[model samples]
Target chain A: MTRWGMVIDVGRCIGCQACTVACKVENLSPVDAWYAPVVEYEVGEYPDARMSYLPTLCNHCTDAPCVTACPSGALRRRDDGIVLADEDRCIGSRACMAACPYGALHLFEEASGEVLGDGSRGRPSLLEPYTAAGRIPGTVSKCTYCAHRIDFGTANGLMPGVDPLATPVCVVTCPAECRIFGDLDDPDSRVSRYTAERGPREVLRPDAQTGATTAYVGLS
Target chain B: MSAPVTAAPLPQNVFMDRWVLGPKTQRVWGLNHAIWFTLMGIGGGVFLVGRAFDVTTELGRVLGLPLVDVVSFVLIAIGGVVLIADLGRPLQAWRAFRNVKASWISWGAWADLVFLTFGGLLMLPDLEIGDSTPFSGLGWESEADGAGSVMLVLASIAAVVVMLYAGAVLARPRSIPYWHSVAVPFQFLASSLAMATATVLVLVVLDGDDVTSGQAVTLAVLSAALAVSMLLHLTTDKEAPGKKESIDRLVRGSSRTTFLFVSLLAGTALPALLALVAAAAGGARNALVVVALPLLVVGGFLLRLDTLKAGIYPPVTMPSVPARRTRG
Candidate 1:
């Protein structure tokens, strides 16, 4: 009954992409496929102008449209509320990509992780190992909230979000301490407490009505 | 102060079209989808009309197939091939049939399969090709009428599913501003009917046959409904995120010429008007049918293309502010 969720305090996010880079390194995601991206933005007129960051990733919705749209039964929601895609079953229809509202999913092509001779996104990539693993060409890939680490940690008798070993790399790597991940089902959990304090916890594209698990704190 | 305001809208994504605050058109689906959808619509539409009229005019002894059967089978076959080709993984397309309970594409795969299999069976009596024909002896002219009748019904049912799938798949994406409407399915359904009628009329004429006044009138009506559906889809909640921008893409953006001139004015409206006049004026009906049917069919193609082009994703950020500004 642990409904895993994440709370992002955008008020504290300083546009630093440390979490983005950390997630890339940990997930071994294609270099262009951002599991979590800190979108740098400028707002207001010159007098009130300011630079801000809107860090975005898969919301892992309870009623995920991508899961419903996936023709091959590739995408599924775990009992813990984590949405995942079984790359093997995926037909590469891109229906999940077309259906995702938060722009969290990406289609994997072998060339996406290509290394150039100029040593830019080249040889030293963590991708070489991942490509040999679950990275199936022509299938879809997305954030799992570090499900591997979660399962690994929990199996080893550790708590996620509380223990560094179990937490999503992006949440743990955020220098601004803007991200908190924990079970929303438990009122005592850090993620639940943060929401109670924040009160009117909001999700991006609320009109989508996908029951988004990732809650945000700032923007205006 | 009242409601949260986003940073002034970001300009369109120019650097390889990454991200933008403005509506971003989905480029993943384009010409392939347009052709595939057009063929699906025509196949379904034409099959419906052919079955309704029972036009059994034989083409040749090669397949011994009639005009309508050949048209529907060829188009649907080509569409299925195109759909498979369009996939990021073409060989694994069989997995598309597994999730029909949830996915439209799954339903489409099943529908397309049922349509082809049963429809192929329905068209079976046509094979006077050689001794290789298993259904060679069976014919509507013979006592196997009941069995043939069952195949006809199944094929017709599958045809309807194929037509509906075309729109339903596109409409499933709620994030898309233009394609999310209920009107899309109607537009596709109506367009399919109109295209089918036009195709039938053209084929009937080319074969030197005359359609009754009633069939001509139906064509007029179906084309008019197509026009209305197109208009309804075009006019939606313009205030919603990416909604107005989607409209701009049609009215003033790069798709302007195709939207206004090709689809709306000539392809849709003009065809409807021509069909009406042709139906009303009696003798000149053939000439007008010749002019209008092709236009209606072409317009149907553009409708699929333009609507596909019109889909725009709203910016994901909600622009919520903390109770007090912290950083700035």
Candidate 2:
């Protein structure tokens, strides 16, 4: 009954991009591949100009368009509400990419090193363990909410969101402490408590009716 | 004096600059899909029109071969190859047939296979292989009767479905508003029909026949309908935020030139006008048919390309800020 969700506090966010770097390093994401990126924009004129940053990732909607759009059924939602793409099942149709309103999904066109240097160099050594499925080419990938870490943490009797090792890298590494991740279904969980305490936090594109699990707090 | 009556602080704009979560999705489909859909249109169009016109019975033959059968067979075959080529795993395309309920793509794969199978069967009599078709020993010529007509009809049905599949695939994506309309399927269907009709007109004209007035009328009506449908599809009320943005991109943004000029004007308008001319003249001017045919084909292509180019992923907007902040 664990419906994993995110509560991003935009007010606390400094747009440092440390979380973006952490996500890339943790996931061994390809160069220029941003699994979690801080979107910054300037508001108002010079005297009153205020810089705002909104870090974005997969919302992992309850009713996911990517799941329906994927012809191969490669993108599947787990019981805990985490959506994962099976690289083996993927046919590189990019249908899921088209269906994703958030643009979280990305298809790898070439290897990470090949783009920056000679094609002779292979994947980064850090990616060796994760590259078993060869997701670096012709396969669509996105943030999985650090499912591997979550699974490991759960197996070791650790609570995600309560433990540093169990939570997503972006959540743990946010120097501004802007991210809150926990089970939304659990009333006692941090995310649920935050939702109850905070008045009327909103999910992105609520009009989409995707029933997105991720919510934002103090977006101002 | 209450701290000298200082002015109230500026309340922060929570939803500043319409910031939303996630970046815009890049267009997944490219030249491969464009080529595949264009080929499918031509193949499907030819087969459907040939069935309607009874090209097998009438129009006799060019060099002792039924032109419709040969042309449709070749086009369908090439289209099928192109479709398979676009697949990430060509050998595993059979997996698509196992899941008919998945998407238009699955159904489209099945439609192509069935259409090709039945179409090949229907073309058996006119194949002219003469004891070299591997199955010539089975006396395949005798099978070209009631069963042949049934297979042809089935093939035609599958072909029609194939023609609509491209638009159906595009329209299914909830993110792209421009393609999300009831008009998309019909517009694609009409374009395919127009292209096929024009192809037929070209053949009729080249064959020295002024007896293609019926086809010219069909072409004229279909092209005009296509033009109207394209206009309506682009201008219709888009309730979805994503769709509204997509329509804006098409009508007034970067895609405006291609959408207004190539797709609508040269592609749909001129072809419709030319078809009308052919119909009015009782299909006399083969030159008019010749020019109009390519225009319809090119116009239909430009329409598809423009649609793909203009497709905009939904914009990220500011997630609503809480009415009140929590201490946690």
The C-alpha lDDT values of all candidates are 0.81, 0.74
Write down the TM-score for model 1. Answer: 0.91
In angstroms, give how far residue A137 of model 2 lies from its true place.
1.5
Please provide, for model 1 over A91-203, each residue's C-alpha lDDT reduced to its tens digit, 9 standing for 90 to 100: 88888887887778888765656656454555535456666866877788999999999999899998999999999999999988899999989999998888778745767
lDDT of 2 by residue, A1-220 (tens): 8788889887788988899889988887655468888887666678988778878899898888788777677788999999998767777777788777777787765554344334365645645544554654566788999999889999999999889899999999998888999988788998878767773576665545666777787654
lDDT of 2 by residue, B161-230 (tens): 8899988988876666666666777888888888888887677766666636667778889999999998
Model 2: runs farther than 4 Å from truth?
Answer: A111-113, A117-133, B1-25, B57-66, B83-99, B131-146, B238-254, B283-285, B318-328
Model 1 chain A lDDT-worst window of ten: A117-126
The collision pairs in model 1 are A219-B320, A220-B319, A220-B320, A220-B321
RMSD (Cα, Å) for all candidates, in order, is: 6.2, 7.8
Report the Cα lDDT for residue B324, model 2: 29
